[model samples]
Target chain A: MKELRWGLLAAGTIAAEFAAGVDESKHGVLEAVAARSGDRAAEFASRFEVPKCYGSYEDLLADPDVDAVYISTPHPLHGAWAIRAAEAGKHILCEKPLTVSVSEAEKVIEAARANDVFLMEAFMYRLHPQIRRLAELISSGAIGEVRAVDVAFSYNFATPRLTDPALGGGGIFDVGCYCTSLARLVSQAATGQDVVEPEEVLGMARLDENGVDEVAFGLLRLPGGVLAQLACGFQLTQDDHIRVYGSQGQLYVPKPAWIHEMRKPKTSQIILTPEGGEPEVIEVEATQGLFAREADHVAAHLADRQAPELTWAETLANLRTLERWRAAVAR
Target chain B: MKELRWGLLAAGTIAAEFAAGVDESKHGVLEAVAARSGDRAAEFASRFEVPKCYGSYEDLLADPDVDAVYISTPHPLHGAWAIRAAEAGKHILCEKPLTVSVSEAEKVIEAARANDVFLMEAFMYRLHPQIRRLAELISSGAIGEVRAVDVAFSYNFATPRLTDPALGGGGIFDVGCYCTSLARLVSQAATGQDVVEPEEVLGMARLDENGVDEVAFGLLRLPGGVLAQLACGFQLTQDDHIRVYGSQGQLYVPKPAWIHEMRKPKTSQIILTPEGGEPEVIEVEATQGLFAREADHVAAHLADRQAPELTWAETLANLRTLERWRAAVAR
Candidate 1:
């Protein structure tokens, strides 16, 4: 059996979940945990039964037993930690949004390239079999040529970090990136390319008093004539469904009303309704749940510099889209 | 029972549907049929058992037995025929999209006002119990404060009348009016007003070779801060849903993957998902069907010279939104 020793960076809630997921992952082990606060690091280490714990991120990065670091800090700090992890010669899996802007994401990508470390944005949903099966279903021409795509990942709760612009926050960075990522994936599946860029990005948002968008909506026209509608916010609870309209049929994920988002549950359902045909429900199961599967995915691709599900290039593209949407909204 | 005799002004498929609806209406009777060809008029009259058959619309308008006429002509001809019908002192039930443009709609409304005749645009869905109950639910704060509304009505088939601009066709005039109408209805319900206007109408479309939108999408910001997303066209088959997102809950119409559109069937469902609660399905049945209920609504409002469900003012407002969307798409 092969194992990739994992060190948890930033002892946050997400890092604790990742430690648990590594326990379930086939090719991963929770070797160490680290946080700026020594108490938090010790608490996480005790809870996860890790062999090592560190008060500083540098200690975790410098650990010889750790082959990879899962970066789950606030997006504002993701780039710095990921760069340090890369320079430390450890495989890096950073949280989504990568950074606040495209330039920062580019810098992080360059650092990863210069360090020659395995890197993948922690868009965990993309690595799940449910979404992989989605790409396969779309590419198989089951729904025909995709024309329109709609994705929403909005909720009603607002966290201090989510609404703080200085912390690389707001709806777009918080939940909207998931939407653009899904839209690009649909484009990738529809065009049979590695990825497709948006030709047009039109956005409208309701900004709070601090100039941070509380709710944001965007329409992206991809190169293949696909129009994707994205809605994300901290003020509204939407159905949060992924709807793909194709030339010959349509595909919808999850079920009637609930959304998958962070919860793929035991089985994921994709309803394919063909033109003049009945809806076919395709279900894909994640044996170890979404987070575990994501951890395993990183371990499986440790030998490679990037993940097939979400690559560094795609991460840069997704950041470009989020920036364009924000600029459009601000305009 | 009081009877408002109906003379269908066009021997078209929609006219036949209206004639059938009139048979089931409470205060309506099918009395006459009119078409350019006398044979077509006679055939429609005989098939529907209409006593009066006229070759010209003017002749049927002149028939004293016809108390009100259902103008089922293409939208390009709706204004002229509705004006003539009012001039001949006949109450009128015109089809959806009362006129090609807002100016045309206003002119027809002016004519109807000058003649002091009963006139209503036949948006049958508005007359159904399903939509009326939706208004009550929203007004009752069942879904809390409305923030976003999404409505789509799209189909794949492109008829000659739909593609020809001169005939008052294209997706905007053909089906997009319904989207705008639903948007206004939600706005009205949310604001507790008879109707509300859009503050901004931003639209994008995929124009065909003939400069007609094969598929159109719109984002409308209402006066009360509700953003509505509308999609309509002849190039795709959308779920054709009416989704309302509120501060505390969300409402989705029809069921799973199907849209009500013209088919109210026996019962219509509105799924209200309260925040942190299970979805509640509210079913409202229209015993007389959608079109028949529309006919009965007009029959019940003939003496008032207006309909409470959809007034000429709201019709004008809806048309203005559609025109603005089209102009935005063009720009």
Candidate 2:
């Protein structure tokens, strides 16, 4: 198989994890690491055992050897870096909340389209086998006429970069994007459509002193009368489960995000309960880590211009919903 | 203990359940039953082994042997019958919602006050030991500064009474009441207040052909910025779990509604996961069925004019919120 050489755009925690994932991928190789400071970039390269390090993002993007770039910068910097990478003729796997707002995401997509490069949002959990099976079951009517979805994703981990307003930091942009994306994915699967947008959006948030939301809740009314209730927070510890309710049965994933799926081998269970019947547990065995699968998916898209796991239109729809939710909570 | 002679106000499915609960209660007796038809009333009386059966509601209200009334009629009839029962100098346990609207609930409360009688809405799940323990834990800060609640209570069972407009049918008035009541209960527990109402209410619903909502979703913003997302439907089957997210930890009740707690012995579990810690499952043994507990609670209040499990103000607040939700969805 042809290898896709990857350049790490930021020496952050997630970027480090992505590098580890790339190391495990059969069709991807972490070729370079980049940071604002030379020492940080060199340290990251040494840690990851990459061959090259760049003192600045522009230098990494300018490297002809870098076949694809993973934009793992802070939430606010994703748009500018993704556009620059696309302009430099490199495929892009941007970390989630692809940009902080819809307009920024649109610009990134436009840039990618204009430059003829592969651009996909790095929503690694969607590449997991369990989530794929979930979508398949919903589409196949395992639950029968999906009507509602409830998701709770929250954890009590706080840092200056996560809570600072200047950094575009908030639960909505950090972890809430996952909830929004999952809602859209399930709605699309149930409707068998390419895209779904919420007809109505309502949200509330608990903002910290820095004017960034620590926790947030959102409700969406999708087409075909599906109601999605989502809760995301950086201030609480929750079970992080996703439940899909349908006319005949229900499906539950104990760990919908599967955050631990990237670190080690983990077994996940999908519980299906038909109306007035016993619950059936379907256990899924982990083969490749979630991020590794994501890396391979990105490599395939880069090789043949195949469709990304998350399309550009779907990402824009999710960002639009997120913008509306932020506005609702602010009001 | 002095037994309170209970009169069954309707010969419906719920009414039968209440009759069996009264029979099991230590301080309540199933004395009489009434139905629109004489034969149905007689049949219910025979099955429950009651001594008296009345063809008309007026006859049962006028009977001197009836010490209290359990109003188990359809949703729309609850207010009128509750007011009549209050006027007849009988203590009342009215099935939820206490009334179809806030105005009707107020009238029923007014009548109860004027007649010096006990009045309570039968939110049976709240009377269960597991729910009571949940409330205690929240009030004691077991989870620490509760911030959000997500509840799903749905089942795939449709009947004329559930889907017909004339019967005051809908998912919201039937099962939705349970979700709304649980949200309020948990909020009140977190805030340590006797009453708490959502500052903002937003909802969406899928109305069936009769203009009755088969499925409904509501979002509430309670005091202290707590967000509650509730979904109820007659068109689907769900896990029917209640999750409370807090700043320090999380608490989850596997069966929040405890719908099956009335029929047989069941042990429910509450899973608590503190920040960065493993979840601890607390198993609670059901000493008395939920309905039996409700029957005993009503009997105790009737004997001493003590407060009922669900107070009139709390019921009014819940109804008012439900009214807002209906209006929001209609808009």
> For every candidate structure, what is the RMSD over all alpha carbons to the true structure, in angstroms?
2.7, 2.2
The true-structure Cα RMSD of candidate 1 reads: 2.7
- Report lDDT per candidate: 0.83, 0.85
Error of 2 at A330 (Å): 1.8
In candidate 2, list every pair of residues with a backbone clash.
none
DockQ of each: 0.55, 0.64
lDDT of 1 by residue, A32-139 (tens): 999988898999999989989999999999899999999988888988888889889999888787888788888888888898889998888877666778888888
TM-score of 2: 0.95
Candidate 2 wrongly placed segments (more than 4 Å): A263-267, A303-306, B263-268, B283-286, B303-308
Candidate 1 chain B lowest-lDDT run of ten: B255-264
**lDDT per residue (tens digit) for residues B272-293 in model 2:** 8876678999888887767777
Model 1 over residues B1-331: C-alpha lDDT tens digits? 5888888999998898788778877788998999999999999999989998999988998898988899988888999999999999999889878987889889899999999999998888777777888888988998888888888888988889888877866787778888888888898888888878898888888777778888888888886678888888888887778889888898888532123534335766889999889999887775765677788888788888899888888888888888898998774
